[model samples]
Target: MSGHDHVRFLTKNMRVDLALIAGMIAPGSRVLDIGCGDGSLIDHLFQTKACDARGIEIDMAEVTQAVAYGLPVMHGDADVDLAHYPDNAFDYVVLSRALQAVERPREVLAQMLRIGTRAVVSFPNFGHWLVRWQLLATGRMPMTATWDRPWHETPNIHPCTIRDFFILCEEEGYVVEQWLAADDGGRRTPWRRFLNLANIFGEQGVFLLRRR
Candidate 1:
């Protein structure tokens, strides 16, 4: 059976970022999941919301696995391949935990907005208090649950803070529809009420954006 056919009891297991992204999506909309590791989120959306969900993953092994499980996933690089998709082909284009790793984040985001009506982005916050404390105390790169890899081995080439992201959005003239910040344990705070505090305290951030 395809992964979509057997998608069951898995949404509950999604990471906090994925769950947040799901809530931002409207039911039955077309979705293009960029850097979709194993097609889990797309499969969940397809099964529960009857959405048309497809994915692009850079890892060939992951792509093969997702396809074998009956998900419509293709092997592709997000930075290079996003240009090939026509304008507004999908309702949502998601880049979950993969933004920092892209070669050109600005270009990738521009393409995402071009190809989809809205874009969802989730990434770990490099300015969390814990990260700051660790760096201050140890004079080394900090590691958190979401950013488990050592600095030398990490794929995040352009790690950024929540405030940085907001500034980037403002500079690019993208409209932020909604956003949230949470701790590593997935507990969300009244982050909207205090964006700066959230930048230092929150472990991760998810944003819903649209062209201005």
Candidate 2:
């Protein structure tokens, strides 16, 4: 499918992240999407940015959906298969809502940096105030659209804070080129001034990072 068609398929709620992705990617760039569930983002990139996009997903169902759309997607674990790609093979690598699910986030991030000039990472912010309130007051894991699964069934293995991500980036020699925070509807939130405090209340966070 053409890039324009892919963009049109995206629901209006997803447009915010799509805009952010468009800002990071240049036209006709090569992209690799890790844990690309259903290939929605890859399709958007291909159609809107004219990108050459490929994806790696673990779920057979999602792979099927991606394939139905004629997207190039391989069924594989991000932890094990990402290493097979040559160094600097893609202009950008993307991990949207997938970082928190991996057992080794640091390792996966390192591999992303090695294989791409830049990477875009987006995840639900556990530091959001509602989540904290749920844990503190209700003593139960929060259930939101992005994190709706029960604790036992949830794919997230490494729930992280905004501060935690910054620390990891520093340790891994990555620089945050751009950062954005969003609510459930993908609307931007004010996180820069009150990241330490606001992140606990924010909904989600997205980062555009480059290897230092």
What's the C-alpha lDDT at position 67 in model 2?
Answer: 96
Give one digit per residue, the lDDT tens place, for model 2 in 52-86: 99998777776878899899998888788889999
| lDDT of candidate 1 over 130-176, digit per residue (tens) | 88989999998988665666877666778899999999999999999
Please give the CA lDDT of all the candidate structures.
0.83, 0.77
CA lDDT for candidate 2: 0.77
Position 90, candidate 2: lDDT? 96
User: Which parts of model 2 are misplaced by more than 4 Å?
Assistant: 1-16
Worst 10 residues of 2 by lDDT: 1-10
Score candidate 1 by lDDT: 0.83
Best by TM-score: 1
Q: Give the range where candidate 1 is weakest over 10 consecutive residues by summed lDDT.
A: 1-10
